[model samples]
Target: MSTLSYETELDKLLKGSNISHDLPVSQLVERALERKEGILTSTGALRATTGKYTGRSPQDKYIVEETSIKEKINWGSVNQPISKEVFENLYKKVLAYLETKDEVFVSKNFAGADIGYRLPIRVVNEYAWHNLFARQLFIRPNAEELLTHEAEFTVISAPGFKADPNLDGTKSETFIIVSFEKRTVLIGGTEYAGEIKKSIFSIMNYILPERNVLSMHCSANVGDEGDVALFFGLSGTGKTTLSADPSRHLIGDDEHGWSHTGVFNIEGGCYAKCINLTEEKEPEIFNAIRFGSVLENVMLDENRTPDYNDTTLTENTRAAYPIELIPNCVIPSVAGHPNTIIFLTADAFGVLPPISKLTKEQAMYHFLSGYTSKLAGTERGVTSPEATFSTCFGAPFLPLPAYRYAEMLGEKINQHDVQVFLVNTGWSGGQYGVGKRMNLTYTRAMVQAALLGELHSVETVVDSIFGLHIPTRCPGVPDEVLQPKETWEDKEAYDNKAKELASKFQENFMKFDKVSDIIRNAGPKF
Candidate 1:
């Protein structure tokens, strides 16, 4: 195994005062490891695991391939045999960090078919949690489900890194790995075995995509011809709710990977907002989790399992189950090139054009803008209605430097000739600040029109604000509903709200003012 240096940049940050609290790493790693072993020895683990978890290095271990992309990204092939050398390298990096944190405990269990180790609750600074752990270890609940039946699913490996403080006041960095089969998650060389799985999963979602996938914030899925469309925005921006249509076979909801052929889901399951979710509201997804669903971090009953009806855990309560659990799940983890790319934004300010066909630059512009209303309680810190701009509707986990993926999108759009559309999945007659949300039924109908290619037939008029062609009216939906009205319950209040939202959009567009004429003309769109 390569000798890993104990000092990582993250370690330095952990020791800084900016951190509110510190959990002992050395102590936690020990406990977490023990828990893992206990779980592995249990009947559940035995039934689930098929092959040996450890083995000698595979013959193809030493060969390294090259990519033109600037970063030295690792591309683990689906066909290549996993190597022990790689595992050792992971172990070494994890061990070095654990030792530095002084919170890790080592174990060698020879009694089982394979040897194992563990870690307990350990403190990891937020920076390390967000950048390193989130980036290196975060696994999508859905992706995990997709790999569940596969041999790679057994270990549930989690690699986390932390830093110690330096002279410049930054932390030294180190990495740690905790395997779930062993029931542990390590931080700063320490192990934590408590209710850390959910926390670990949450942090992981925050980072892992930056590695190799072409991740977008938009809702992406494979269409009939294998084309993928990505819908993006904050929670309640219609990512799960809108994409739940039965007409198109559902790929995974939310996050997706842009593979060479096309896009594939990174998750085996969907993490949807359950606030207003119901059989009538989201019938397709609501029925998907009846038997196989695993509700995470939820309020449990006497048996220590989740209470599906319990709202005590907060509205963010989530459920994870394999996509196959859904009545119709398209698998093989691949989707064809996107035929149409629809970026969904819930425009609270009803003044902006309802729908617009985007040119290439406009697509990137809106993606970077990442327009979505900050619904009151979806996130922890966001309390009010704030406009968020995430590149490609997914700013958080983008792996390649932003533009690289944009370039890839450009390449794909050019090659496959995919069409892009921006739809407001929010209110129309009023602004988010003052008006009511757009009716779900109407939004769904609009989406149906766009997907079926019927919206293109509407009379085209150059929108005054953005200059993009706005369909005068969708066939099934009313025209008056397309634009915000001034004569609602409070006309003056509606006008004020509209102005505020329009200004916000313009302000958000200022940074990208330098984009080329075609692209620029394509945006600053209302």
Candidate 2:
């Protein structure tokens, strides 16, 4: 029989609750079905709904201000500050609430694939399904490693426990508080499984940079010749889908750290957006959705088969599966330095070219701008395609200042002589409503050309307003499509929209201080 030694320590924290430690997948699945927390789809995958919060509650997230790392944090609207007293008080309440629960599921895992930098973490979930999520998302340890493991950071999640805004100093009843001093994260009032994954990512974002490691919110893949390429973009920009290329070995679908040695994946799994998923488009991700995968807020048909097209539940429908499930995954999830970096944007305005090479300064400018269009229904309250700027392509999960990550990225690009490209995965002819979405085949061909360095020898034209070098020709792409303005019937309309987006870029750049003149001048000049 396996020992329950780990539970003894957790039992003291979650007093009075029936502690279920390191339960196997079968047992956890049984417990989840027994409690009706989730159901098994015909494919044997577990389907669960995260009531009230189908997505991350970014507004409710907090970082406790303490003496140890008060100034280190970029405290503002994004990284909200909570007094140490508030964290302590709420911490006690969360534990007390967990104690009252009938059962608690515990998962002990590691966060980084690189053992040297990996953080040992323990996650305590109120629902068995959540434990299953931790199992699929985090790096699992063997029996011997589990016996001797000690968590560097711990996450206590009880979605059933809602905070009192007036008393707990939170924006709402939902809260996700990270205490650096206590080395713990307390999550309540939100059952979004993403919270569990992102909490660890936030911690790593803070911890990794301090160690001179550049933590990135991007997807990575390695070519046959060991060439590494990074895809940086926000949620809807196809980072996950594009990086799962059959021609390359996927390092990871999301979250990576670039150190002096190489790039390492911060996660052991891929949490892919499942809405509109089709087997013909993404055969690998589609095929990986069988047993052991956890589907969140996904709608199902009468036969209990998942309806990837259905958004009745949520547009943020996701599927979490281990990286090994991907046919072309790197086992250790580590690779040498990246040779090329692609910044992806879903440009709803369609004024941006389908693909453009970026100068060093321009790369830094776009990295800080991190512009992407959020399609309607991707998140609650988003009714249309809205242009959004998230620094480093993932501002919400970043705990440090935006410039720190940008600086690290710039340094890496210079040191390694990396080629950078800006690829628009958004619109082409006019705007979101008027222009058609960029054909996936064309996008793939452009990406392939960029990766293969075929565009280096191609003739280029400078975008007058945006100051971007647009390639006049690519191997498989039409010459007319290379120039976005030429593709539009009304050239004047394209000019107007391009200038408008340029103004928005300038306006957003004003928020950052102490940026170099080179980066400052790299924006659209209209």
Best by TM-score: 2
Tens digits of lDDT, candidate 2, 436-480: 889888898999999998998788999998999999889889889
Stretches > 4 Å off in candidate 2: 1-11, 14-17, 377-380
- The Cα RMSD in angstroms, rounded to one decimal, for candidate 2 relative to the true structure is 3.4
lDDT of 1 by residue, 223-260 (tens): 56554666656566777777777776777666565645
Clashes by residue pair, model 2: none
